[model samples]
Target chain A: MPRCRVRVSTWRRSVVGGAGGVEACRSGEVPYGGGRFNGQEGSEDSDSSVNRKSYPTTLRRHPSRMDQSESELKRFMSGLTLAECVGFVIIILTIVWLQYYRGGFAWSSDYKVMFNWHPLLMILSMIFLYANVMLVYRTFRHERKKKLKLVHAGLFLVIFVMAVIGLSAVFNVHNTAGTPNMYSLHSWLGICTMVLFACQWLCGLLSFLFPGVRHALRAWYLPVHTFFGMVVFILASCTVLMGLLEKAIFTLNDKTDTPYQFLPREAVVVNVMGILVALFAGLVIFLVGNPVFKRLSLPEDEMLLNEPIN
Target chain B: MPRCRVRVSTWRRSVVGGAGGVEACRSGEVPYGGGRFNGQEGSEDSDSSVNRKSYPTTLRRHPSRMDQSESELKRFMSGLTLAECVGFVIIILTIVWLQYYRGGFAWSSDYKVMFNWHPLLMILSMIFLYANVMLVYRTFRHERKKKLKLVHAGLFLVIFVMAVIGLSAVFNVHNTAGTPNMYSLHSWLGICTMVLFACQWLCGLLSFLFPGVRHALRAWYLPVHTFFGMVVFILASCTVLMGLLEKAIFTLNDKTDTPYQFLPREAVVVNVMGILVALFAGLVIFLVGNPVFKRLSLPEDEMLLNEPIN
Candidate 1:
């Protein structure tokens, strides 16, 4: 076969077919034309039980002297099992301990922030945010000019911004520079962020359903998918905010627990977020329909031995 | 062009594959996958921004002038814009109203159930069970045999059994007619469900990192991707149980709330869930790394678009 002399760097991006500096945005995931794999004709014929156990039919046979195998095994034998047993015990102990110390909900409205369980929820929020942020940062470092870089950047900006906002709220300092109600700003940015978030999901939906969108944004692969992850980050911060706010409003506990006092009154944000989430869910269902249901199962998502569909 | 006497039905089936099943599962918008023939290469790339913003775009364009262009014009006029407007309005109103109605979190000792804020959440559990059971029925409906069907059916059966146990706990009606915690049977199933969920996400992750899995699964395809989705279904159901358990303990309110009379004396379960959720969050991070602020801007992903390398 005659080989085409394509530059490694040049060919790296020859897939999506976008334009200018923004070459990453190519067609959607679906090709304008289609393909030829038909699965309908002999649909899953099987005589096995519904929950068929592993059918690891040995397809190859290699003769090995049992004596040699035993001797080699003896050479590799260590206290591996014993170590694992101890490790398992440690994990159980850790979980049990957490249940005692940092277990259940604890919130107090000693601040004007009123109803924010932010401090309490921060325990989980911090872990999630810190770990996720680190992973995202490292991925960026490794793939600098990667396909979907814009998408990755767009998502990280959102994550950092939220983290900052959450921290300030936790410490009772305004992080947005110049803003009071975080209400109006939060409402506008939240809605816009929500819209962008929807676009991110739609991009994936199109990748599987529309083709053009998939191939349009370069390979549009992982980076863009990472953008979809922005949702989880937003969720963590918001959940923490909700938890914190719960304390602020209800004064679940007073100075007896911490140093803070309640403001006037405001306890409606959680409901707003819940409504947004539910509505977003309904809209996704409407847009993607039945296919969306299958995707909703994050666990089943592993069946995707192929790249993640969305 | 030579035309062979081919069965169009078979050809279409082969071409469509999992998309056909998804099509069966979803509703398609009129444009199919949009128009404009995608323009030709070397025809000069238009500003997608301006092109996107052009008011020439209209929804519900009723073009009755003539011929094929007539349908095209009509479609152009009757496009996505206007329809989305109406949909957006409805979502806003519903969410706002729901938010207005949701009161502060309430506690209950009897573990009866709280149906206010999470009204649809509990119903979602039922819907999940309903969908699974129906799919199981469909597996056995027509073509008498299929290995994949049976395997998936086995999956559904496990879900069904768990759901039954869960429902029994909720309504106080188990087959054995036990007094309480009938749903404890579901907890054993939870481990299996979590494992399966991990498998699904792993499949998705591997599709990207492992070329063998990608090539074999055609990491590019959707059908192969949906396999992971099935596992995701069971995992999501497990969360419903968590939600219910959370609600049960919610009756206790916060530890800071009161003298602890209205609260359920059983505080152990709440603590257990918190630690479990924390551990789960940690595990999920291990599977899908965190998103945050770092050298997050990537460029490799942008190389695939076949455009000017920035």
Candidate 2:
């Protein structure tokens, strides 16, 4: 496996040569590359002493100096937690909007009901799970880089599968009802988002995961990948908002007893849901973009990551 | 008047004590704080030699090192230009959508035609003008900071006025037609965007313009201001998209001869317009958010900015 190819000797050399010096990380003292490259693949039980000893002298030198930075870190953590909570609220709102106001979900038997699955599944795949995947690196900074990559890729895969199903549900309903598909602006943008997302995932996989590229190439591509990830996420979010508006207008028009323009109960719920989705997307982007919240690379982690494995 | 209060002696002292050393910028060599705080307020003629001479030796030491960064800066410039082009295209498309597909604009004479002004003016104010206002700092990085602030505030004031007219157009139509107001999700979110935009403008004025806050408070609020600026822009974009969808559905639904679902010419044009708006917004956000494109503070500018006059 690629994980095993990371040379432990290189890490040791870098650590010994680091500012902490060889004396700081003597034999059997730092637990050999901080238990990450010690042939313990997938082991979650990392040694606490390794973490403490691996910190650079600059960080450990002034405990009082870290108070402001520590509080900033805490704010970032709380922001992330709040984003997750908002995400779940959006999910719950979507469910309630579909179940209580509109009819509940179904399969091919009921085309209208099948359309309900589209919004729920797309929100789950595109907005909620996709946001979490973007946060994995920032969230689990202490974890092994390889493990975090695995989790990121794995969540993306799940999102892709759900997105595919979501697309299928909408297409199936359109075909069954003999209605035109991909005609509206929502569908046009939605298709673009989907294609870009798939391409982003593939690029990310090739660059960072299996059959990884060279270190120089990976470094060059990393920022591009991150930039496109945010772009695709935003495109998806906009598509969803448009889709919600379209669905709300179509289903709650003048033909209905309580039309959308009348500010009916269901219309208000859908509007709130759309607003929440936008809020969630905005918060996630802010958390990712703010430099203060960025995940700092530890010395040991950097040593391991910089190894010329690829 | 506030600009005159900046102490030029402080900048001279800081420049003399800088790493380039006093020898690099002797008396009459640096042109006295690079001609910024020399009471020549609002003068557009900044000395290019002063700019070249004021650069730190670390930057000027390696000519080859400047090549890559210079190319990156060129790319950022080109990206901003491209975003501006896209924004203009969006405005033109909105005008066409309003004038050609929908009826032409009017005042109180014809409520239906008056409604047409809403989309065109909203797009002009919120999308086109707003994006350009955000790009002013990056576009005119070498300009006097106070002049840029004035330009920024001036452009925003224009946007605010246009937005007010845009809102009035819609409200006038709704009132004259005896229809409801602020009922749709589009109107709700649009109101939210307008309110937030006004508040952001006020905060910006109070913090950076007349009677400015303390430097420390301004520093703390700068990022918050920037973060909210982006959020409000995105919210505005979303609202515009929703408004487009609402109008398209309302005017081009099954009740019309060629419904929206039929992929009519108007529908396709509207869809393309919406997509262009999204692209413009995304490109603007990228141009603004990408760290590579951030406006670098000149040494002279830093000296003047760091003055404790505020």
All candidates' TM-scores? 0.29, 0.80
Candidate with the greatest TM-score versus the true structure: 2
Q: Score candidate 1 by TM-score against the native.
A: 0.29
- DockQ, all candidates in order: 0.02, 0.25
lDDT tens string, model 2, A130-222? 887787755664445666776778889889999999999999999999999888878888998999989988987887774536665665566
Per-residue CA lDDT of candidate 1, range A1-310, in tens? 0111222232223211111111111112111111111100000111011102211112101122222222322321222223223323433332332233234222333333311333423322232332223233221211222222334345444544554544445445223322233321112223333345456545544443342342324232333344234334333333433333333323423434532222221212222322232222322211111111100011221122233433
Encode model 2's per-residue lDDT on B67-129: one tens digit a residue: 433554567667876887788788788887788877787785699899888898888888878
Docking class of 2: acceptable
Docking class of 1: incorrect
Candidate 1 segments exceeding 4 Å error: A1-155, A171-231, A234-275, A278-310, B1-145, B173-310
